[model samples]
Each structure stands twice: as structure tokens, then as C-alpha cells.
Target: MTCVSCRTGLDHCHGTVLLHVDGGAECTEPDCADAVLARHALVVDCDSIEGGCACEVTAERLAHAS
Candidate 1:
């Protein structure tokens, strides 16, 4: 599947897909998250990644660490 915003394949998109913690929106990319946070001053949470995506495993680990 592709990212709704970027049209990039989720499996190939760079950066982590994060959800805005304030119920704003899901970020299409990690850099997108940073940009949104910087621009709008909002905090975000990492959304569950696709199971077959390479980032899926690392995302879980990071989630647990935080």
C-alpha cells in the first residue's frame, strides 16, 4: 500500500510514519512528522508499521524503549 499523503509506497517511504498524538493526522514520513511538529508545535506517536516493511521491527523496538 502507498502512503495516503505522499503516494509513496509505505514499504519504501523514508522515515517513520507517526500519528499526531493530538488526533490531528498521520504523518506520511518521519521528516513530515518533524516538520509538522516544528511548524505546528504538536507531539506525535509512531503508528503501527506494516508487518512486512523493514521498519516494522525497529519501530516496535523503539516503541518499547520509549
Candidate 2:
């Protein structure tokens, strides 16, 4: 998948996760948010990190989700 911030193709980006609060689902890649929002879902980063792309927070949420 391509990064939402960088447009880089990533084969290992699945290590991240984004949670759509109202939709009760999570997206593992940057592009995943597109689908969640398309479903009229509400999502948040839900992760706190010092410096990185917003998508980087997915790493934290992914660990928690699993």
C-alpha cells in the first residue's frame, strides 16, 4: 500500500493500525482510513508518539489491537 503522507509503496506497512471509533473497526495501512471514512465512520489516531507521520501511531494501536 502507498503511504498517505509520503506516497511510498509499502509491503510492511501492515504493522500499523488505525481504529475507527464509531465503526468499531481498524485499518492496518494508511489507505485503510479511506475505506473506513467511506463507510461514514469516525476514526482517531488514539496513539501518542514523539515525532513521525500521523500514520506512525498505527504501530502502537496495532500492538494493542492484537
Candidate 3:
């Protein structure tokens, strides 16, 4: 996977999520917010750090989806 931010392969660049966070304040997020949230959050990363995402693969997924 290549990082969308740096255009560097993930294997070479250190793994990190620029906007990653965990256990943030709970709120009733609207369903319509998925796209926006997905843009700002990493969906699968929640399992890694709890309520947070690592956005590492998103670039790859986005790259593939397109």
C-alpha cells in the first residue's frame, strides 16, 4: 500500500495515522455521516486501538476503489 499523503510505500514509510484517535467521546453519529467520517477516520482501525483508526490501508483501498 502506498500512502496517499506522502506517495511513499507503506512498507518503507513508518506506519502512522495523521488523524488517528481512540476512545473519543461517544455520540450518536448519524448514518449519513459515514462517508465524511470514513474520510476522516479509518474504519478497521477501531479494533487495533479502540475507537480509533490507523488510516494506513485506506489509501490502498481508495486507490483500488477508484
Candidate 4:
């Protein structure tokens, strides 16, 4: 899916899926929980990275749990 605001297609984003909850209210659909987040502003780690910022997993990680 893509952001209705930014229109940035995250369809091809190849990372774990997770949720975006706020307070007692959920931010989005159950699909929102399908994304895996980094839990930090800009910090992440992968099992097998090729050649990228190990901590720069923003786009993917930010897809949820921000």
C-alpha cells in the first residue's frame, strides 16, 4: 500500500510488517500491524544486509511503530 498523503508506494518495501497504534486507539487497519517497526526514530538491524546503513532502516522500519 501507499501513503494517501505522500503517495509513496510502500508496496515493494521488503521488510517485516507491524502495527501503528496510538493510545487505546489503533492508527490503521489490521494490515497496519502487518509491518515490523524499529521502535526508534532512526535505528534498525537486519540479519543479512548487503551494503546499506545498518542503522538507517528508516523507510522500512518507519512504515510502522513510529
Least accurate 10 contiguous residues by lDDT in model 4: 19-28
What does each candidate score in C-alpha RMSD? 10.9, 12.2, 15.9, 14.5
How do the residues 1-66 of candidate 2 rate in per-residue lDDT, one tens digit apiece? Answer: 555534543223333344433334455455654434444333445343235444455655877899
Q: After superposition, how far is residue 49 of candidate 4 from its true place, in Å?
A: 34
- The top-ranked prediction according to lDDT is 1
**In candidate 3, which residue ranges exceed 4 Å CA deviation?**
1-53
Q: What is the C-alpha lDDT profile of model 4 across 1-66, one tens digit per residue?
A: 644433753332233332222212221234444333431122133323346433445555866766
| Cα error, candidate 2, residue 63 (Å) | 1.1
What is residue 11's positional error in candidate 4, in angstroms?
Answer: 4.2
Quote each prediction's TM-score.
0.23, 0.21, 0.20, 0.17
Which 10 consecutive residues of model 1 have the lowest summed lDDT?
8-17
Tens-digit lDDT string for candidate 1 (33-56): 344443333334544444443445
Ranking by TM-score: 1, 2, 3, 4
lDDT of 4 at 58: 55
Q: Each prediction's Cα lDDT score?
A: 0.46, 0.44, 0.38, 0.35
Model 1 error, position 9 (Å): 22
